[model samples]
Target: MSTPVQRLTAEVNGITLSYLSQGEGPLVVFMHGFPDLAISWRHQMKAVSDGGYRAVAPDMRGYGASSAPDDPALYTQFHIAGDIVGLMDHLGEKSAVLVGHDMGANADWAMATFVPERVRGVVVLSIPHKPRGTQPPVASAPPRFYQKLFQAIGVEDDDLHRNVKTFLPAIFDRLSGSSEHGAPPSLMVPEGKHFSDLFEPPSKTPEWLGEAELAEYVATFERTGFRGALNWYRNIDSNWWTAAPWTPGHVTVPAAFMIGTADVAWALFKDNGVIDSQKERVPNLLDMRVLEGVGHWIAQEAPDEVNDLLLNFLAKLEARDS
Candidate 1:
């Protein structure tokens, strides 16, 4: 049996962040993306912890057990980088390896850029450290892009709120490698359909996600609503503005990146210049793995593979540090 993860909270950045921790040693913080909670890293946390490295996954600013701010403007990258650095201060640590996926990945990039001294190394899944374009993100977004659709605000929340239980599971199924969900439609929103309408709910829970595991997410969203999460997207343009001074700044720390071939992010963002220019920007990027058939839910869809990759990276990180 695996060691049970401990639940803890840190009062940081003027808010409380509930985080899951396992193992003991140097700190490694895992951040989850939109539509996901800290538990999303349950698999990686265990593997890395067992591999003899501390793993910490937090319910980021607008998700799950963490406090969610009401104003979308509060979700900027500046706030994100601060929360993480503050979390480290709360834990009394001076440095850590940062691991992130999706929105979590975005925050990791920001933290690495904003506070390089605090990062020992970095691991990112799905999203690469794409340098900012000259134009504002929202203004430059593709037609009917999901991120664009999100600017409508309350559109997705109203749709998903209609059937939290039914719609929530679909996102997991359709986003995983196991799903027959052919090329994901433009992420956030390609056709301008309601968030729930864009996906077909699975007939059964995905193999990687247990019904009980899914129940937790459903219950959480059902209670918290998707406002805090959607608010992240609402502030993309503002994030670009805050990111202005740091645009083109690369993550100089040792880094690794992984993405599933079937992930919707790959299909939608492949040509957006993030993946293409990842190497030029993230110079220390040591490993880049492409999981042949996995999707956005890399940790859940292929836990064993993800675990091995994380352990390998952690080992390399320790070697580099020592």
Candidate 2:
């Protein structure tokens, strides 16, 4: 039987963040990515909490029932990381094992690097910790990265908003390795086309994603619009500028990085030595695992494996502290 998750809210970093939590013990906070809610970690939350750790997954600022700030500047890495710290303060905990996926993973890397003392351990999924490069990320990529496309503001938002249901399901299908929903589609969209153009109408929801879950995501995006979430992407350049001081900085805390073998992000970063470079970027990286048949949504696609990895990492942390 799964532990029942409690829906809770707190004033953190000047925003009201809504989160799902359960269990009680050492803190383990889960941060989700774009187009995802706290519920995205439903399986892992229950698993971790049941394993004797207090598990909390927040909807993140500008997401779900959380307060959405109009200014894109508010979504920077500094602000997001601060919110996590503020959450800890609100919970009366000094530090936590921070776990993040996708953009959330980026924030985890930031928190560990910016305030290593506040993070007992770090686990980042899908995205890797890439140190700031000399040129803007947009300018460096051969084909413009999606982050650059997102910087266009209204254009991408219009496309996504116009086809929320189609877009969401399509992305979920395309990113996964399973052929249950048919062959995954290419994510690359041509300059003149919308990102939604890449995917055809999905035949059926992938086994990893359910109709009810997909409906929930669609409803949330319909209510919140893509602006708040897109703002995070818009701040790419600004984040680069703000993170300048930490140019040579590395995550010195115990950390683990995981990604799926078929994840598009893997393709993007593989050429850049993303996995191989972790030794230098995260000197204390405890483990790095690439799931053989998984995709971008590792936690959701393989919840049991992800839960096991997390529990094992936590156990190792406990042993180290003891």
Candidate 3:
């Protein structure tokens, strides 16, 4: 039998955040990426809770049932990190193990960098921490990078919102490494085309993502247009500017990074020494695990493997503490 996962709300950083939690022990907060909800971490949450730790996964500040601040500027790394810290305060926890995926991994890097003391250990999935680069991301990235397309406001949202159902599944299929779907490596929208115009309708949802699961994501985006989520992308350059002062900082806390071999982000960064560069940027990085034949949606696609890695990391931390 599985323990029931509870839905709860917290007043953190002057906003309401909806989250899912299970068990009642040391804090292990999971932060999910864009186009995903707290439920995305259900497998990990249950695994951790069953292992005698309290596990929590928040919908983040601007997604799902959480309060979405209209201003794009409000979605910076500083703001997102503050919300996680505030969540700790609300839960009366002095410190916690922070686990983040995708954009949430970016926030995990920020939290571990800016407020090292509050984070006992850190785990980032899909995205690795790259210290401030010489040039702006948009300029430095290849012309085909999706982040560039995402930077343009209104355009991406219009296409995404216009074809929510088709667009969402297409993204999952393409980004996933499932041989069944045969998705491409890059998700770049054509130069003169809309974002939704790039993908053909998926014949079926990938094994990692079921129709029921995709429906949940579709319903959320349908209720709350893609504006809030897109705002995260809009602030990319601004976040780069805000992080200038912390350029010299490194993730001093114990950290681990994991990514799927087939992840689009990894494919782009791997050639650029991004994965190897973690040694200098995250000096205390404990491990870097690359799962073969996996894709961007790692947690959902390989929950058992992800949970095992997380548990192994947690066990190491516990042994050290004891």
Candidate 4:
């Protein structure tokens, strides 16, 4: 059956956002991550809406048909969170369960903090609670190679064009950690190699994305441009400063987070203990689980398990509220 898609126009943080929502019941808003659109939640929208909750997903400020502004500062978590609240207001919803993944999860954290009354509950997938008033090293590290490149060369305008022709597959491969299979020349790069190494074609099929999937991503980036998405990364410090007053960060609403044990975030920060620190921030954290075989795209990678987790969490929250 075809899931219904609705378009909404609302002004938030000074930019108009275009969102897609379907089904109807208690409102549930889905916020997507970098390099993604509301369409990314096609499966979750169907599952959640069919389960009796209105499932709403937005293109946010930078992706899909949403307004994309030139100022990087506008993409900070504070602003993005405000956009969500504005969206709820536009929808005539006083409160909604907020669900987010990747960059969207970052915004979800801010939303739950900035407007507690407006968030019935929150679900963080592939991301943990980012405590207010705490600065983690990884988040503070010098910009990643790609980020530095984006800043140094003013690459956004052309990057999207090139990506459709060249870079999207590599990013997906690297993010999924499945770039190599054959000879070193086809995939391997020396230690300390920069993103220049990413230009090479993958030796094997990437486990996370295929040609059709990549084509979709490439087309979206091409149409929407990647700058708006990259702006999220650029506003890290701005987000912190804007959220400075709300310390002792704790979500009074029921909240849960889940990640794949094999996710690259774990591999990258295994020694940093960011996950444990993240858990400490949410006082009402009801559950935290690491799926055995999944990766960063927890929802897409393990939908059935993700759905089960969400359904149970929502049930518990409903019980508590009753």
Candidate 5:
């Protein structure tokens, strides 16, 4: 059964974020991905709260019921990282174990890199560590792409805006490649999908999310709009430049990268290395396990496995603390 979601708001870094929280333990912060809200962590939060820690997940700057600012600059890595820090201060926590999925994982990487002392450890799901450095413009494919088309100022205007209902569903379907009503297929071929497809909704409704879950996301987006969330993609170049000073360095904290074996992202993992270019990126890297039959949404799709791995890892961290 799903844990009952509780709605709450906290001001951090000048932004007000509405989040769904449950459980009790050492403060834990969960960041959700695109088209998701803090409620996404319900399973994990319930699993870990009993360890005397507080399990908290925020809507992020613009994804849920969080305050959405007008300027794109506010959505940069530094600011997003600041939001996490601000959250810590608000909760009176000096440090906490951080976990992120998808874009949230990106922010987790930034947090660990910029403010090591504030983070005890990090567990990344789906997203891997993409170092900030010089790289040629990435090539794109028709169906499978990573270019951020939504970042453009006017892409969502006119026809696309009018047909968002149709667009969203189609985009989600293509991205998932599995009907919302059925089980997702194991393998994802690199058939040319782009970052532009991110903003649109899925052609079919996702089976995993019920009306309550979907309502939370829809309401958040409706209130916050998508600009703040899209700004993360918009500032890819800015983030690289900002990290240029810190780049060429490895993460010193204990870290793990969990990927789904069937996830297309695994294709990017070469030489058994997760991040490209830099060697020994995560100096204290513990493990990188690719779940046998999971997709990009590993946490949601395989909650039991994710929960067990996280518990074991956190237990070790707890042991050292004691």
Candidate 6:
């Protein structure tokens, strides 16, 4: 059974964010990434909340039931980070541990950089920080690279909107460690092919996903469409600019990074200066784990391991205060 979550909304940073919240005690915020919802953290929320922490998972600025401003500009790093800080203020929290995955990892890292005081600590999954590049990210990528393609207006959204169930499950399944289909989903859109052509949607989703859970994901996207979420990709270049003042700023808080070795992102983070230098960059980095055979969906794919890591980090934070 899924954890029973209290659905709530907060008016933050001039927008309303619908979030899933469970349990009580010290605050712990979970943020989801692209094409994901707050419920992505359902397992962790229940575990952390049971361990005596308030678990709050916001749908993020442009996904799920949250505010989805049409302008791509609103999805920049500052906008998303402020939404988090503003949510904290709305909840009357002085400081809270932030846990995030994918785009959420990106946003959580931004929060730590801009407002470390409001952050007790951060736990990020999959994505490790890459140094900001000089030109717009899209400038260097080939036209069909997924991120570059998303920069153009309406193409990807229209493609995905045609078949949410098919494409959505393909995303979850193709990137999973237990995926029956071999080879990770390609991010490049080949000539004469749309982004959704990356893989055929499996009739059965990866084991980690439930039919009901997937239904909720499909329904939400069907109603909201993908423009708002895809807009985040659209603003990558602007986000790069907005983040300039704090280009090399460090996260001055206790932190942990967890990823499955099989996650597609491992190709970028593994043995690269990203992890080794992350400790130097984020001086308080306390844990970095590479769980073998796991996949991109680290939290959902390996809940038991992720729960242990989250609780252990939370306990360590409590000990520091003691």
Candidate 3: lDDT of 18?
A: 89
Model 1: worst 10 consecutive residues (lDDT sum) = 183-192
Q: Write the per-residue lDDT of candidate 6 for residues 218-262, one digit (tens) a residue.
A: 999999988989998887888777788997777879999998877
Model 6 CA lDDT for position 54: 88
In order, candidate lDDTs are 0.84, 0.86, 0.85, 0.72, 0.68, 0.87
TM-score of 3: 0.95
Q: lDDT-based ranking, best first?
A: 6, 2, 3, 1, 4, 5
Q: Which scores higher on lDDT, 2 or 6?
A: 6
lDDT accuracy of residue 293 in candidate 6: 85
Flag clash pairs in model 1.
Answer: 33-103, 146-188, 146-189
* Tens digit per residue, CA lDDT, model 4, 123-241: 88877775554673235555553444444324654555555546666555545523352211222334455443555656654655556766777677777767777777677666666
User: In model 5, which runs have C-alpha deviations exceeding 4 angstroms?
Assistant: 1-5, 136-146, 157-204, 270-279
**Pairs with backbone N, CA or C atoms under 3 Å apart (clashes), candidate 6:** none
Evaluate residue 203 in candidate 3 and report its C-alpha lDDT on the 0 to 100 scale. 86
Q: Which stretches of candidate 1 lie over 4 Å from their true place?
A: 188-192, 271-273
Residue 291 shift from truth in candidate 4, angstroms: 1.5
Between prediction 4 and prediction 5, the one with superior TM-score is 4
Q: Assess every candidate by TM-score.
A: 0.95, 0.95, 0.95, 0.85, 0.83, 0.96
User: Where's the lowest-lDDT run of ten residues in candidate 3?
Assistant: 179-188
* Candidate 2 deviation (Cα RMSD): 1.6
Model 6 TM-score? 0.96
Each candidate's clash count: 3, 0, 0, 0, 20, 0
